[model samples]
Target chain A: MHLVGLQAENFRNFSTVQLSFAKHTNLITGSNGSGKSNLIELIYYALFSRSFKTSEDMNLLHWKESYLRTQIEFQRDGVDKTVVVSFNSNKEKKVLLNNIPEKFSVLFRESSVIVFSPSTSQLVKGLPSVRRKWLDRILVRVDREFTSILYSYQQTLRNRNALIKRKLIQKEDYDLYDLLTTNLVSLSSLIRKGRQDLIKMINAVISPTVSKMDLPMFSSIELKYYHSRMMEDPSLLAKEEIKRGGTLIGAHLDQIEIFHGDASVRDFSSEGEQKLISFCLKLCEFDLIQVKTKNSPVCLIDDLFSELDEDRAQLLFKYVSSVSQTIFTDLTGRLIEADKVIPLTREENTICLP
Target chain B: MYEFTPSYLKAVEELHQLPGIGPKSAEKLAASFLKMKQEDFHGFVEALQELREKVKQCSRCYNLAESELCLICSDPERDQTKLCVVEESKDLVAIEKTGAYNGLYHVLQGVLKPIEGIQSNKIRLKELFHRLQHESFQEIILATNFNYEGELTAMYIVKELKNSSLTISRLASGLPMGSDIEFADQLTLKNAFRGREKFSEEMI
Candidate 1:
């Protein structure tokens, strides 16, 4: 997949900007605070209809502006499609695919993107919740049934928690509890299996990439699934869950631990090593998405030059340029060899540097 | 605000109280009523008045009825050993229109919604349990909506009748008859896949 064009209005520091992209590699060079990251963010938002940086949509709006709008035109499977995302100060957001309104789930099924930003290191260093979310995002995109299964599991968990909170399970309520737990067990098993399968596929792609990178600290990186024991014996957990007055176990408590040799990368790896692992994981993500969807995803690398050392950056650029369409930002304005180069300047607002 | 007469404003206000009829729609309905012939207008009002005065809940199944028992419960040709439970009388009518079900019905009047302060006791579940105890049903079908509250209510009924020897089932949820699979929502498609039936060579 490749992005053909992007248009934005009142989005972050870019008041109004329209630009086309190359099918292979596009280098966005700009000074500090020149809205380079914002451009990449707009591309991400157009695909997902949500910002990766912040949960609040208002933060994407330009200062003194009440609304932000962005449109992205991309080609997938030899067909052109447009995605438009608009948000106002009232927190109302609208997403349109090919001028027709759509839910985020449907949009995600059609488009896929792998982002490597400054915060990408969080996958290795952040809490277990982050890794679980990452795994779920990828799994949901790859399998459509997984979305509904996950949704049902979440709803069942909420209802079960509510029932437990009542603390008065009537004779009749026992059956309800059993029904809910049965659903939770089955759904969690499906989710656990989906994540496990995704991790396996990702590991298959990532192991060689990590090894090929010749990073000594992470010569043998592995992605492992850590699930709650309740998945195997839900009945046992049910007894403890009633005493705890909440659900004691499920995929919600699961994690994806990244291991480097004998220890967790989060505990032992250096910052640069963590970043490299994250980069490898994203490359695996790009490959997995392509293999699953049969369409390569647009890769967005923000501040790539600053994020990696010269050798690592060159390796990443070489890999992405050969396999997928990539757009990366550089602040030094150094001429990076690419199919297209977009130089941005920051005055009161961002503009294309002549 | 004072452009219309008092009776016209009152008519509009009453029309607006109907579900899904906003203030603008209420005005439009009232204007259409005004444009109707005098006899037709009186007939419409009389029909509504008759509905309120004559329509009563079926004593046996709590469905809408004009007599002691609902039409389905009283029909001699309908299956007496099968009972289909629904959340509302409108659902009974919808099923009846499909011409697919010839079994009796028991309207719960509403689903069990604890969050909305609607407990099992608040609805007609007591009557349902009483009927279940007295009636010798071979099978009971839970035809509730495919939603969280409906599922909860159905589960509660199943639990209540756990000791009974009757076969119990739920309405199969799937894509509508004319909908394309590509257009069906994920939940609907998933349910359809879950409830799919195996085909046999003899049936073919």
Candidate 2:
């Protein structure tokens, strides 16, 4: 699937903007603060029904505007599809797929996108929790039942924590605590298994993608998952849990580590290595989503050219555009080989395709 | 700004206090009341008055009733040896509509929600245990909603009755009838797989 065109109204700094995209490569060029990234965000919001930058839907609205709307037209399997999303000040969200109303989650099933922004490097540079959450987010799209299992695990963990917080466990409460622990243990196992399988898939795709870019340093990259603790001795932690007034062992504290030839990337990798690994991980995500959903995902690259050298940037662009339709935001319009370029000027409310 | 009459405003306020009726809906309902015929309006008022005055909690099972016992509890046709426990009178009503259950019911009024300070004592668990001891029951079906608190309450009740001779069971939760298996959510599919019934048993 590929994005064909996009339009937005009263979103952030864009009062109104419309532009068409090419099937292979599209470069969005603009000076600083020219709403270049905003255009990418509009497409992302239309497909994902949420913004990667802002968690609050209210922030998407243009200043002095009470509502925001975005429409994206894409082609999948030789059929054109349109998705329209609108949000109002009342916190109401509505999505229309092919001109029919649908829930926000339908976007995930209908289309997929893998985003690589400057912050994507955090997967290698940030805390373990960041990597864990990223895994969960990707799994939610690839595996349908993963969301339910994760939700159940979190709920069971919270309830168990609340029970422990009561301090004094009554004689009759033993059975309830045991039951909660059993449920938590089983759900935790499901979650751990899901993460393990995802990492295996990522590991499989990461190697070929990494090699495609000819990054010999990352030829042996692997993603490893570390469970918080073995569920066998949950009883051993009961006392510690009661004292701490919360849970200590479960998927909630699981860690994910990315390694390059037995060396942890987060610990030993340079800034350039980290960025390239993040890019490869996103490419794996693109391949996984494409295989799982049977539709190629539109790759969204936001403000990432500046972080890498010009040579690596060109290679990244060539590989991504070849695999899937890619839309990249460039500061100086350096990648002049793109099939189409949409230039934006500061204070311009309209985008004319060139 | 134009102001409504004192009585009209009061009517709107009262209507707004009811569940699901917002200020705008309340104003519309109050205006509709003005257009109602005298006798029709009187009948509506009489019905509300009767509901408040006559409706009472069943002394036996805590289901809504107009007498000492709920209709189900007073009925001779219901199975006296089996009891189905629910979290509220509304849940009991829903089950009754199915006509699949011929047994009596016990409404707990609420579930155990420790996070919200709703402990065992806040609901009707004590009354349930008291009924179980006094009344001869062969089985008890815990029919709570399939949520965290409801499941916890059902498990707690089972633990309390661990030594009892009565057969205790929980409602089977999984895919809805006639739903396509492909469209079923993962959690429901997991449950359906776990609770798959034996074909031999069904054949018999």
Which candidate leads in TM-score?
2
- What TM-score does each of the candidates earn? 0.86, 0.90
Docking quality (DockQ) of candidate 1: 0.33
Residue-level lDDT tens digits of model 2 in A197-303: 99998998887888777786687999999888765565667878888888887787889999988899999998989988988887788778878878778888887
Candidate 2, residue B59: the lDDT equals 98
User: Which tens-of-lDDT digit does each residue in B1-204 have in candidate 1?
Assistant: 449999999999999999999999999999999899999999999999999998998999999899988787889998989999999999999999999888899999998764444566679888988888898789999999878789878988887888999899999988887889998877788889999989978766
lDDT score, candidate 2: 0.85
Tell me which residue pairs clash in candidate 2.
none
Each candidate's B-chain TM-score, in sequence, is 0.89, 0.94
